[model samples]
Target: MKSEAQTPQPNDLQPEKDEHKDSYNNIETPATDAENSNIIDITALENQMRNLSIGFNLKWLDVNVLPRKVVFEIQHDVQQKILKPLEDVVNTMQTVGLLSMEAQTIFKKMFAMFDGTETEYKFIECLKSADLYVVPREFVISNELRPGVIHNEQGMDNDPITGILMPIKFQLRKYLESPLVFDTILDNLTPSQDGYIRSLVDGTIWQQRRAKIDCNIVIPLNFFFDDFTTKDTVSPHASRTSILGIYYYIPCLPGYILAKLANILVAGYMLSEDRKEYENEDLFSNLVHTLIDLEVNGLTISYNGTDVTVHFMLGFITGDNLGVAGILDLVESARANFYCRMCKRNREQREKDATEYEQTFRTIDGYENDLLLNDVSNTGVHKNSVFNQIPSYHVVLNVYFDLMHDLWEGVCMYGLSHCLNYFIKVKKMFSLNELNCRKNVFVFGSTNSSNIPNDIKDTNIIKSKIKMTASEIKTLITFFPLIIGMLIPEDDPVWSYFCNLLKLCHILMLREIHPKLLDTLKSLVETHHTQYQQLFNDTLKPKHHNIIHYASFILRSGTPRHQWAMRGEGKHRDAKQYSRVNNNNTNLCKSLSIKAGYKFAQNVYNSSFVTPQIDLSNSKILDYPSDITFNSFVAEKIRLLNNSVHFIDSFIKQGSTFSHGTIFYVTYCNIINIFELDCILKDKSNNLILVCSSIMCRRFDEHLQSYEVYKTQVPKLISNIGCYETHTINIHSVNDKLYFRFCNFNVTDKVIESLFVN
Candidate 1:
């Protein structure tokens, strides 16, 4: 509740005293003030130079580029020219030690051609081209036992055999004994340089140019294979074996160069200052002491092959190197002085706050009645006040020092210990409890939550909330955000965690809205899977008409009842039940039946709606067949009305609301249905045609009197029988097509004649 800024601490007086002393010293030397000032300026410059030297030294400890280049060049030359040629010579000599002059001459020529070229490729070519090529087995007869010798026979011969010589083995030994042979060969093929000339060139142009050197440092070949075998022997009976190649890169050069440069720079800087008499030599001395201290207290040194490399480059640069022993003394002294200063400051700050609080307390009328402060007589209770409490400043300072010590120890040990020590130190300085408190304050202040004191809260609530926290709010403010992130549409853990924190914070803070409101919203969205269903319906509604039309076409194209019996029956049941319950036998009943049928049919097509089946057996029932009517006049009227209902339902369900184009299309489609009735009449038998014509004429008179006919075509057949046979009418296709059948009817002569005469 208290402001962190109001909490004060003591200040050191030594800095002030030192300033006064310096002023006094200046006044005492009034005759040479300018000279004295110059001395101080020079001292400051020297101190800065010392610091820069230390920084560079630390950076150099990690890597060195200068020496690395030399090492790399040496390695590159050895691998490309020396190692490959030596390997080939060793392999060749093993098979043919003593050769005829002609063969030896040819061999030497081929070796010269391939020596520094693509050695592997040219060697393979030479072997294939050679007239007297031999594998290792053909050359050796006596298998003398030696450290690296290989034998396949049961016994060993102590003396050299007649035609046998180990070419690869002999050549390898020759090269090892005399490495100068390959070096000389490479020198003849490439450029030559003496040590003095190279040094001269390096001194003249090295610093002026940046060289980009690239090379694939080879891994040692010896490590890859244990032994090898030879085939195609001259005797066709002997065998041979030999060890494969041997190599590893030297990584010390780069680091070495870097350390050398650092030493040069640091030494140069120190010498430069020593040449001039700079004042405050103690500061530079302290810097030198710090470097020594870091080397001892911070740096970790290790050897790689022949070169020495130091870890913790920063530590080296920052170290006070008065010497290892002196560095420790400096650290101890600094730590003690820092701690004493902090402790004194905290005590002074506490006393100042206590005085202010006492002054403020006197202004309050019922200060004695208020229980804000403890009685001075009670030591235990009084100890709880800020005046008696140990300051957090000292605690934090101690933590920082401990952290530095741990970091030093970690660098010496290396690996996870170093990493863990760093993390622990960081956590100690920025405690999680304090972090949480700050987070809570930010959240409350931002949301304008009533739980936060108004006086402490900001007036521009919206803007304040926007700027309140840089970090995202926790998963505790609102339940809807959580539930929506979780179950309603899809699951997302990150979103859910965030929302949950927001909601939880909201509840804990007790804002204007109750927790129940969020719960209810979640419940509504979740209940009956309503949110999911609504989302699905809204997405699918526009496509519903097209789906229905496709389904109807598929059914009319001759799908058997058995294929869709369960689905059709379910749709019929839904239509009938919904009609019976909601319509109450009014005109709405007719409308409901049509709407329900349209909706049900749509669901059946979707394959998502529930299907009707026998509960116990899960068997489907077939849709009822339509019955034929003798009264053609009544049937025509019913057909016209059904067509209208179908058109309206389809139009309303598929068409976009408030669109004139949709309205026009619906009207046009309905008109087309009316014209279809006339086409049907023309195709019927004479007797039925007469009946259809009369019905159409009467309907036309009632509905189409005001409109002029664009084209009129009267059908040529008309006939009727007073008594007709009952027939079955199959509603094969609900939309676009229908089929019917007449059965058990006698065709009277008078009716047949009337149909022909008409």
Candidate 2:
């Protein structure tokens, strides 16, 4: 285990002030005029300087403090948790062509990691992205309409995504190093007459499943510090606020053009140092070499008279965060002179303006030009000898943009926050002071929301300097556009513009991108820049002024909604909060590793063992009696008038509640299953659901469950939003909770219609 001191960070280059200050000429202020005139200033200024003891000591405050002791400790944890989000992703991937018999999904084994605490994450429950939050509908507010507009008595509550426990690193390493333990497990489980005879004759214990004390897991991690490292003169975040890397002592994980990170981390290199080869090999090469020596490199693992190929395919490395200094050798700032990775967007500004904005979409010729000139320099994949040497590592392909940070934060929140501030504070459309005052008067009444900040004193009441945090902006952007009907006029351009943005998000992030998706996205991007730009600047005085530009990246890269960096950020949020437990700043990395390790393990597990089937010999299935016949449900009220239970029907069937006039979209639905007329009332919860499996049917009487979960997969044309693939129904809430979170086909015909043939 190594502490953070062993890791080197990078320093930021050239502050904005240092770079821009010299560009500005002297202003012609009255003082500047008189000083330049050089007529009445010399003696008069001296006379005016006859002041008292008033002296303002104005120097930048530098509080010296020590850096947080960065370190890594192999938490002696073998157990792990199951993350539902990753499971959902897995299920979808399996449904798609990603997982076949040859490339089977592995690692379904259980390993317990931690005890207690709220480790569950509530997914957005629709479209596609791993960005997570458990926001309640109570936070949504509107006027001239009922409060808690999105709250559906039938909607899902605390809908959880499963997480997995961390694997025993020691056991993994040991098994990979030698096949003795793995062979034993596989051999014992292998169907052979001798094994069966031994189980029956020698010991009945062999019939039962077992898990051995795998190994005392010891992980050998490379803690390299690359010299290309950058540093700062002072940092308040560190305890001793003096000379720190741009990373603030945090090790950069993005750099390894190859792994073993040359493993700069394994070798302890700093960014400040110039480029030099430790062993004439990169990090990836070094890692393979070390693992080869360790004898655990998976190329030799034989089972069933066949070798199991374990070499991972090197998909292109993605740039995360600001991309100032990327982890892998390829990622550079997207806004650099060579701005785009996918196209020739790096051309001069005038040239960019001539081709109807060539920066957003890639033309065949432009892409070809980009390839020829840059040589795929953006990702460094197509460079000479790189692609040919490593066929598995494709260059300039599969590059991603992050939805959560780059799009939602960079553009959506960045732009929308300004719009909201303008409408609420400048236009006086919504009142924060009123919200605060109402909460002050009554804690439990209609005015109070669990989602609202309890201590918020209304920015209107105080002269404030702190801007809204990313989370606050995210909360607004995620739900506000759909629910803004009651807050603003329908004719308002701001509302229309925001709605267009929402439509673009849906088009980009939908399960199967619509055929017209690219074109629709381009139109929206151009409108935002040309049309909405004038409105915001001439009217709103936008804070997030440059958000229009980010739309280009999305159009070119496709949806980054499914990227991992944003999810990592989201998971890191949980860890970051936990690390605040002590003022001592001890084991910040240790605490985060536990959280992140479990998050990672939940996705990667021992595929050798499947989810253990329930032993039918030991347990009996219980069948619950139905309380209500299918006839008991109010037909007209339930919208069963024209509804057919056919497995191949396409029509509208919306949720039962509303979030600001919007409804939960159960539209574009094509049924996949139909049972003999039967509707069961679940115990404790009176949810009425179509009967299926006893296990799935038993949980119907719950609250806040989404109807989409139970629906089987259909053609993308039939249903696109909030859809998940499941053979069985798993509805969690009653009909009332299935609120109108979005619009129906009757309302959003054009958008949803694009999914189908004419």
Candidate 3:
């Protein structure tokens, strides 16, 4: 309700003064007395000139005048060029009803020409040109005059009414400084006030009327005299009658111009008030607290009925800007309060009307008559109207809802909703997936009998299928990871990856896929591969020799020609021909071939073998059992071998035993190492390295059990090794190749630490 002029005072004026004072104090002073003496005393003169400038300008006529001054300057050029034309059009509109299409078009063109441009000088020019007076007066009036009735000898008509009236001409000479004195004298002589006095003395109504008419005649004569001097161009005596005739009747302009000027001033004042309100201490403090709450707690304010309610929600603030939701909520709350108040007032009025009707009719028999009368009084013969039955709460709530929607619509113009919806969907998906996984795990055991078997055959088949399904799910979840990675700040690489995985889980949950199950399988595969690759590269004589060999195998397996070349025999010829025939038969066959390639890669890339220590630990036969325990033997052998010997088999064979032995000795050592046996039988004089083939055959079945467990469990063990944990080597063979590939390099250690420690 406070005017806008009141608002800007504290905000603009005080700050400006303080800034001026600060600038003055901060100004560099002359160092020498001579320099100080030479400095001009301009401060007082500047202040004087500034005050004079403010006084002359109509925009600076009031305390709240910043925007007026700005607008006045900006429209000066347009005003200079178009003010007369616009004024003419306005005057014409007053005389005529509505403008014709052509006249309207011309007016629109003029408005567009002035309004669309941004010239400060033109704005000042416009303000200067608009300073025209339709009628000359003896005194200058303030431009800040409000719309109201003014008394004149002619009559007490409304200020805005337009009609012919005697023209009042006045010279600017005598009354320039004391315009109010002249105005006071004329006001006292006007018919509306002084006519009654004249009537009381004259005793006759006719005499009083003539006196009033005489007083009206004097009003024009006063201005004419002011415009004239003792001697003029034509003599006062010669033009007395003509001047009297001219002064009798002229035109009266509407007072609405003054009213419009007042309205413009009011609007400017309101704007200033708003500015000051923004700078007020109490309001600013409240705003600061509100903003802080919005930032820290995700706090949002809304109105429920007449009361304001605040809401807090957790999660990162999204969209283009922060605190958008909080702002929207505040607006909604205010609107709800407004609607509630309005509804309450309406309900009160309705209840009052109902109570009055009930009080008027006391008896039951008179109720019908009273109801008819009440209906007729209130709604003109309405009988049980639908409006009467409409619930107040329903109407209030509807209005509240509408206002909230509008408020949110404005806030969401920046596209916050799309981002929020996407994030929410992902979060929900993650939650649902986790819930379902827990439920499933509770309902079923770790392994199913129908799918899993007691032997290695069934276990291998089931594990492979599970791994394939998990890989597919992982690939699907990567979409979310990619999006999350894009959203996270580039400076936070660790958190970026963390959020990427979290979002991936969220996306899978939304899709109704069990993320926990997929995540577990992914972890397992990653652990196995990471550990195997590390040990394989670390122990190999040539660091990546094994990996290169694996790549070469893949390249050969991909094409029939390469496969036949690698086979080194004619046995592959028929098989190669058949593969080509199958490829041409169907698109399904080609798809299957691609899938087979991927499966083969997965198997070869993720192969897990037991560490040499575990293999030796399970060995039952040893020549020097006391000296050749599992840990000591494997550890010593690993220490003796080069780090790269596991992958570079030729290097290992060349470095030791093979160089000193014949084909028989080489074959015997290879068999013993491949099969992972300790020499239990002695030949001649502690020749334990050479064992009887029959003894070896006898223990072969027992060795197979240990070998199977070593192959399976060693991979699991190596895959589970910590980064800092020590490992021992085991000799294992695949496809007639003796290799020490497995070493304990656990991947689970880091993953567990990250997930469970904090």
Candidate 4:
């Protein structure tokens, strides 16, 4: 990142020396010293004006005013003489551009302005004002050293764990001034707009309110930390790099608009090969030291005759299980007796009795007392967390569990592998080759093509633990029932148990969580765990123990989706790409940090907060026919807009894509109904009218754990619900009959009752 304007020197006034000129052979020109003085050096003069101090420097006229640099000016009559011909060329170039051969003529005419000319300069009077420009500044983080042990080179020689830190205040100030937050707040600051802004406040049941967040601008920040390998895993020269990422969401704008702004990488360091220590207090202390002042004083930004004080508070410290345990100074080994971070349960206690896990929830006072003991065998605490330096943050309350690691990769992989093995070897439903053939032939939609899982290997199946990515596992599980639903028996206990896991996944993936939904999630997790132990005759893994605290975590924090490590892990791709192209392994951390700074500056300059545009070529405007007739209400609605309707095949709005065959739900007369989009109509005012066909909800199938529905030929007319309610569906063909199953969350009993009431 570049710094603010630097102070200029007096020697900068000298003109450049020509290399071709020789003192002995130079010819004396007719121009004298008086004639040469008429020519002004415009570049040097501007530099002198920029660096002049008001009180210290003497002005030419003793007037306290700064000067604005101006280029050559054009006369009024001269501009009008060429205006018509210039307009003609501009109009032609606008219609036919650089792709065509005719653009050469336009370029020739445009270059005439600077063919050959002597430029003139002027200085305009302007008042000097104080402006703010927040730039990224790098700070050094060093490991601890013994007293009287001085290093020759600043911590690089003695401590190989030295890292780079980007101060949080500078990054926060830049974000607050960005169009994402500044423009949105300035545009809608009225009494009626308070409700819309207040919804963006972090108001989870467990979140403590430092100030009235709704009235003031409060930024709730979530910090993510993880380690990723930049080199290929198969290669002998593999290297591991640890990264720290920051994420914040603005309440006024929709969540999807800010998706690209999440997971900003701010700190990183290379992991040493010889370092095997569990705790690093010095590393984290340097990172959070700057945040202490930010939490108390708050950042004040002045612009447009107003000073806005914005507060920064820690929302959550999130990462994978290993990363989270490392930062919190807990036992990093999952196989240890005291493994879980949220509770203190020994292996014997977990295996013998699974109930009352909440009775041993970790608290602040308990953690403090355990720090005094400094024993990892009993309390699982070797040292205190560096994040305790922040005022309102606590390790037990702020650290969140990641579903990408715990459920998708851990529990889901283990359960699915066992079920597949049982189906192949014991039941003799189908051969493994036949199953792989079906998996290869299944057609995934365009949006999901990149997440397709690889072929399942025999070795993985035999071990009862599959190896796959989180994205692949999620995609496969979503359509797993549809792929092999018919092969299994209708009343298989193993298949039913797997469905319970599916229910738990759907609920956890939701962006918003209701109190009623938490009850459903808690029951589903308990039942899923009990079923796993009874069927497999095995004890709970460490991930299973971590899953026990999710409901309690969500009750205090917001949704788990916002705290997952998926986005943090995704950010490693940039670093890997940079490493591949440049092959710079010596100073990898510093190189990645500089690249991140350039990306951040580009995002701010281009104003990436703008909404996505819709392409009109994909749609067509419909013409009204004189022969068609409609009912009174439909005719009146059409007449209100003079029968102007656009029939769109597909279009994007607010980062969501709507197409002809999309499935959504809407409330009509206080009842929710499932509607499959048949066509879309837009009037002159741009309000959408959905022409959809209703799919009747039959019943919530216990065996499939999804809603069994039959698509009806009934057509319905309703307005667009702005995509607030939607669900994922799976299609099945059983004996030449079509079956539809919809997976949804927050399904209250009233919604289920309403579905079957008719």
Candidate 5:
């Protein structure tokens, strides 16, 4: 922990004449003629100040403190009054059209409310608080601000890219010491749920202790790096303001906690373009050295009144293809002969669908040899990466591909667009107008309502790009079969290709992929690729080639879903949001860091965990069910009525939400069974009991791409499976026949292996 130096706090109730005069100079007033300006208007100025003071309506404004402690208390109260509004002022500068200097002037006026006892400098001092203070540093010789909004007029070196390096060691220590985070990590050493063991710590390598853990406690860390545009792409300044954001998170935390922005820590940021490779390496050297030092001499932190040495290693690095290329210092061009960082395969071979040649993968020795070669075109290696400096990590093996970009945006988009074009344009199975109409009127399930894809435009279909976000593409592909399957024949080659692609996506996204499933996954990829090539007579893109390595990556790491850049990319939104609000282009990185520091400090001060809000006081309590073994089910049984069933509209556990009609799966009699949440119940100990109505799967509906299921004769009083992971299903009644379309097709296999399934 970093020790904070105690500075003397300002006494806001008392004003010094010199300080008040300085603050008065900061307020801007309209210039007037000498005669009007020279006239004495003290009474009017005093009345205007009094009117402005009325906004706070401070009752203590008239209090006369007789004791030192009372004066200190009043000063503290005044500081608290300014903090909230000051934060608002800082965050809303762009909305109100004020520059940094102008905002500083307004802050001066705000401080004047404390009887001008302090100046703007003192207020800034207070804002710095012991938590963190961000100051922008120049990375180029020109001493320009950030690259985009400013130009070097003095003809200095034009290589301008400002950078901000945060305190990583401090953040790591804080995370280790935080009870909310540390306790969760400890509790989740194994899978928190039955079949959802996707965290890095749960991987075979980590479980076998293949990696070194020489301290009393080990923290698994995952680092993410990516480039994002701060400005809209249509703007001329967009590329200039492009930023390379660095972020990190603990993989040991539950998936829900890891998804939260509060848990993701920002390491640093710098302008991405107009910078040399070595400069990027230099930016990461600080982080690299810090990790090495911590690994060598572990950080001892106080946890639960005991001190333990905490050590951490880089679990993996995740990013889009371009970002991964940059991190590994490989040739970034996807069109290059050796474009892939993981393996060496040229475009010609992939186009030919060649598999006879022995595969050559990138290795540490190969990387070094490639670095020595003068002409490195044949080899993808560009230069040495600073990430390889870690003790047991190598950029070649530890760096993983992001499934979001590779699958969702790349493969899914291409495959779906081509299939859609073939169906609507070539085969003429259905008109584009009809498909669009169906999509717009389709009723999505509750889980997928938020991620519905946008209307497919003519240009999107014509170009075979399927312009949509990663999430939108995933949703569209999952339900695409349902929307148009009735019109297409089951044996249609194009439809088969699309279905194979959809199945591949579902298997890749499984949280706990069985070892046997890897072979299935590999076969699915090959089958999908061959089917696409045969149907369209087109070559597979680089993403299709990249996915050939996913199953192997999953074995080395955990599931690809957990290691994807979806959440890490989300961290970029914070900077983007702050950019929109502050609009401090000159010191963009500095302002964002300061704002993030305040938010992080607030998180640290408050409880970082969100308690589940469940109140059933107004509902009636029912007796325990007669068939269910309540005593055997619960560890400690309590009396009924007090220890009874309390029905709730919904139940929230971890990050999953359960409600009536929500379908989930469990294991019974060594077979996979399905059930719907009938109602929620709570025992005297507040443990939830999930009363579900059983459903039986009849057959797989090929047209709907879902299990044809019907409700059982009676609702079963099942216990021990409440609040399990859920799967989405869109219940439909067409021509008096009911059908259920699963949001994901692989839910059955996952449920079978889950230990929680009973």
Candidate 6:
């Protein structure tokens, strides 16, 4: 393993000292030795656990460099964090008379999960035998008894290995045997809008892991391509072109994170070639044959000993990989193509009023130089085109629309920038007072900071990424209902339509088709196009901005949200970071695969790390000695002076202020975009306001036995929630009417940490 010192300078984790100065000084706490020491190498720990169970006594470290103390720490953590909880539940079940006779059978299985007896690979073998399979690294349920089920929606499973749930093998078999059970399972985990956003941080390192896992592993034989920019290989070959590549995409994984690497099938590169030749079906089919021996062109994988023998279902190629593969233009390139790859239109419209190109028969046929190699003797031969080589794959649905590229960079950036650009350059509304006002509110909300939030007046990370960042686009999409949308000048109306388009992009993921949304989108596009034509005389539009033509048919497959390639793109970052140097440039293929493999190992070992309640006993050191009031959103924090202590004393006596489950706000920090603090007035004459963070009662999930987390609903993400703000909540904003009781910590000596940046 590469040491910290050995990491490349470009991928260095250490930010320059002066680069970012967080406003809340109390946000960071010194790490305790216990916290630092408890960190475990996932592979070693798994091996340790497996070895420890083989005999009776404590296991010795196989690797000499690893300290005995570290092993003890990991053992303690497993007992305290994992097994002890199970032990307690078992005892409780015994005491309550709920432990069933059928449940009695799973005792060994549950024990095996940790004792190393019942491992993921063992379960995978079972799944393969039962005609069901799962990629263990995906952290999802793996049963294929039903159709239309996408990715795992549960951010936190309800400890699926509990006394109440059936045996793992039984559950898998039941789901595979019954579609109703599968549907019930999906319904149980179907996420709410807020819940989906909350899961964003659970495994953010593997952003869009679920999507990639579903398409690549769960969808079975998904035709995919991964996108990455690598340095040239060793010695004689190293240039921009030599390091870049793509394919029918399911061959690639989503989001370049480790989850994506876990799905990588074939890795290769070459000089420019004929489009048809490069995109041959044989290329992907041969890979499938290798993965699981192809049964008459169908692939079946059997887990060792288990009855699972899952047949892999392969699909047509889909990727955000630039259409530069050059075989055909029938399918629009992910980045610039405005029209839908399935149906040629880029926006919503009537069947009769088809303004876009009609190309449902999406094959390269018109040109004399069509690169399609139609051969009669090929194994997976198609009708006329080489693409038809795959039996079940269809050209229309085969084109998987990438949400990250098409929406984030392509659609959001394209539409938002155009509107903003028009407002700035055309409407001459470059400087909106509302935006500046909100910036003041954002930078220093209820705290005395004469200056705006750091770099708000200067820095443009949004524009720095050539107009905007994916995160910025994400903010606009999510907060369109809450905050960001109001910034658009109402006069244009085009921006409003575009914002709705962005919202639709997000909504499609959370729920299925709603005619209202489709109709609304269609109407918006109709007016947007007319006004757009009026603005530029109906000239050709950027393909990304043509949501008007393709929005309808694309939904026929499912939301683009379900097939985002953001995760695949992120895998490149991990590859670049970990790749060992070979005369300066990293070996792209090997290095990438290695990084991906390590990441998969990490996931396999620590899959449940984020799901459990974080032990914050040492971290939650905060207090509020006195009441605080603010006269203005930009005003300084004020301690109460002889003004009625009634409010404070009353809550203090009730013990409702700082106890568990009491929600509170820490008003000094900024949680802009998702949940911001805007000035509101309950009493016009009062000179005081509360200093708090935004808080809301997170919706309870009986299934997961936890709460649904929403970014807008909870003010945790941007704030230093772990240190200073964890105990605080924000005041109700003017626009958002949702307000719970204000909370304040009992001020102790520990509260001396600076609450705001100077």
Q: Judge candidate 2 against the unseen true structure and give its global Cα lDDT, from 0 to 1.
A: 0.31
Question: TM-score for every candidate vs. truth?
Answer: 0.11, 0.42, 0.13, 0.72, 0.75, 0.45
In candidate 1, where is summed lDDT lowest over 10 consecutive residues?
218-227
Q: Please, what are the lDDT tens digits per residue for candidate 3 over residues 1-758?
A: 77887677654564333422454456654344333333533454444443333223332222121333344464565456666577577658845855444444444444444442244344334333432111211111112334455564443443221111111111111111122323333333332221211111111222233343322222111000001111132643322211100011100101111111110100000111222223222212232233234323332222222322222111111111111112111111222211111122122233122111213212323323434666332311213212112111011111111111111122111112222222334333233244333323321211121222111122322232212222223322222222232333444433332332333233222211122333342443233233323422322111111111211111211111111111111111222333322322212222222222222222212221111111222223322334333344444443453232221111111111211111111111012222222223222322122111111111211111112212211100111112212211233332343222211111111222211111
Candidate 1: lDDT of 14? 26
Please give the RMSD to the true structure for each candidate, in Å: 47.0, 32.4, 45.8, 16.5, 15.7, 22.3
Model 3 backbone overlap count: 37
Pick the winner on lDDT between candidates 4 and 5: 5
Q: Can you write out model 5's per-residue Cα lDDT over 574-670, one digit (the tens) per residue? A: 7776565555566566666655554554455444633333334344554444544333323232233333545556655555566667776653322
**Cα misplacement distance, residue 623 of candidate 3 (Å):** 92
- Per-residue lDDT, model 2, residue 101, is 26
Model 1, backbone clash pairs (residues 3+ apart or across chains), number: 49
Candidate 1, residues 1-758: lDDT per residue as tens digits?
76756654464232343432465344443323444444445445444443333222222211222222333344346555875576567557645864333343434443333242233233224332321112222222234553433385555435432121122222222221232322322222211132111111112111111121121111000000011122223433223211111101111111111112111111101111111233212213333333333323332222222322221111111111111112122112222211111122122233122111222211112222322444422111111111111111111111001111111121111211211222223223333243334334433322224323221122222122212111122211221121111122224222232232232222222111222333432332123122222322322111111111211111111111111111211222332333333322213222332232223222222222211110112212222114323245445444554423211111111111111111111111012111111211211121122222111111111111111112123322222221221111111111222211111011211122233112
Q: Distance (Å) between predicted and true CA of 533, model 4?
A: 1.4
Estimate, for each residue in 587-616, the C-alpha lDDT of model 4 and write its tens digit: 656656545554444444444545433324
Off by over 4 Å in 6: 1-223, 231-237, 240-285, 291-306, 321-340, 344-388, 430-466, 476-511, 536-551, 580-587, 605-758
lDDT of 6: 0.36
- Candidate 1 vs candidate 5: the lDDT winner is 5
Model 5: lowest-lDDT 10 consecutive positions: 59-68
Q: Which residue runs does candidate 2 get wrong by more than 4 Å?
A: 1-306, 319-321, 328-335, 346-389, 434-472, 481-484, 538-559, 571-629, 632-739, 743-758
Tens digit of per-residue lDDT, candidate 6, span 626-658: 233333432322222223211221111111133
TM-score of structure candidate 6: 0.45
Candidate 3 residue runs with Cα over 4 Å from true position:
1-98, 101-292, 295-308, 313-522, 525-758
